[model samples]
Target: MFAGSNRLTIDDKGRLAIPARLRAQLADEYGKELAVTLGPECIEIYPAPVFRTMAQQIPKIADRAKRVLVQRLFLGNAVESEIDGQGRIGVPPLLRDMKALGTDVVLVGAYDHFELWSYAQWQANNTEGQTHYADAFAALAVP
Candidate 1:
């Protein structure tokens, strides 16, 4: 169970050292291979099997418009990465720029996958999401 959030720093070369607790979870579930992909507001890191399963679920369609949408959303931006001996994974330049990530970042565990966010960006996003979903969330929690 990956839980809590950790503030992380990206080295000049874009390598992020996974938190020790998260590393233990990855090691147990994924061995050493993981996949990193762009998310709506951040980046998602997943165990290889989980990533592959998600990729496979992208709908197959012969129509050009649907194909383009799926391709751009799922295939165009995906990146595969592996955790090194020191439990660090490098973020690609494009992804870093997309999320406005700098030396400081926050890694948030999302059950099956993890999300990487710039500290400021995460704060803004979290606030917006909470406000946007507050009503729905409260209803879901009814006893």
Candidate 2:
């Protein structure tokens, strides 16, 4: 049900505060534990239960090579983190390095998780993706 985008900053210590609106939901569902990992083009943050469910189901991917690659890169690099008392979670150096996360970021709500994108990369690609929205909508049978 998460359905919004939030522009945020990475503090000098490499942390981003979870937006206030989502804080209580996250707190009730996960307390302070979160799983952070790589997504196709962004870093993803998920509640512990949600991440565990997805990780468990990853073996269902039929292609062995693709599954292993995803397992290695996504799950292997995944880190379990605690939201500090201040509501911030620090993105690890390795995860930040793997993606182009600058100080500026866009945290997008993605139902079970949040996808964090580099502001520069997001700004550069967002407009270009608009042209394909119609195709995407059609593919989803949204018309």
Cand. 2 Cα-lDDT: 0.88
* lDDT (10s digit) by residue, model 2, range 1-143: 56688999999899999987788889877777999999888899998888898899889999999999989988998999988889899898888888979789999889889999999888777888899978887887554
Q: List the residue pairs that clash in candidate 1.
A: none
- Please give the lDDT score at residue 126 for candidate 1: 80
- Superposed on all Cα atoms, the candidates' RMSDs to the truth, in angstroms, are 2.2, 1.6
Measured with C-alpha atoms, the lDDT of residue 127 in candidate 1 is 89
- Candidate 1 lDDT for residue 110: 89
> Model 1, 81-115: lDDT tens per residue?
78888889988888888878998899998888889
The candidate scoring highest on lDDT is 2
| lDDT of model 1, residue 121 | 88
Looking at model 1, residue 130 earns an lDDT score of 87
Task: Judging by TM-score against the true structure, name the best candidate.
Answer: 2
The C-alpha lDDT values of all candidates are: 0.83, 0.88
